[model samples]
Target: MNWDRIEGNWKQMTGSVKEQWGDLTDDEIQQAEGNREKLAGKIQERYGIEKDEAERQIDAFAAKH
Candidate 1:
């Protein structure tokens, strides 16, 4: 669940991310570039959720991956 590992494997992770947050466009995910904060922010924007909630979901997603 390391951000560094995700960042290093951003391209590979994109598909899973998209699968989890289907509302997000590819361009938005690309903009994240594997930064946890950016991805969380996007999830917040798309899902109308709080930042912490977004982080929690991302944490869970990363945990499974």
Candidate 2:
């Protein structure tokens, strides 16, 4: 469940991402395109959370999948 694996299987992973961040639009998820930084930025924008928090959530998510 490393970032590289997640990035490589991004299309399959999109569903999980949406489940974790229901506020994100389909377009925003697509914009991330498997980039951790981009996904964190989108999460930050939608949730009004700090960058660190967003990244932490992503880390947890990555660990799960």
Candidate 3:
């Protein structure tokens, strides 16, 4: 899905995101608020992964949800 769609549906998409990244806290997810870059950055911070890898993960997640 596109970022716009994801953002529009953020409230509903939270569970799916949580399922993918259970290590993320509620506050962190709320902070992301469905912005792709913010979510990627948070994922990078939480998982200690490279920014590119986090973006790739988010791309895959966008495909799924």
lDDT of each: 0.93, 0.97, 0.92
Q: Arrange candidates by lDDT, descending.
A: 2, 1, 3
5-50 per-residue lDDT for model 2 (tens digits): 9999999999999999999999999999999999999999999999
Looking at model 2, the pairs that clash are none
TM-score of structure candidate 1: 0.94
* Estimated TM-score for each candidate: 0.94, 0.98, 0.95
Worst 10 residues of 2 by lDDT: 6-15
Mark the regions of model 2 whose C-alpha exceeds 4 Å error after superposition: none
lDDT-superior candidate, 2 or 3: 2
lDDT of 3 by residue, 17-45 (tens): 99999999999999998898999989999
TM-score sort, best first: 2, 3, 1
Q: Any runs in candidate 3 off by more than 4 Å, and if so which?
A: none
For model 1, what is the alpha-carbon lDDT of residue 58?
A: 90
| Local distance difference test, candidate 1 | 0.93
Best by lDDT: 2
The most accurate candidate by TM-score is: 2
Residue 19's C-alpha lDDT in candidate 3? 95
lDDT per residue as tens, model 1, 1-64: 6878888999999999999999999999999999989999999999999998999999899888
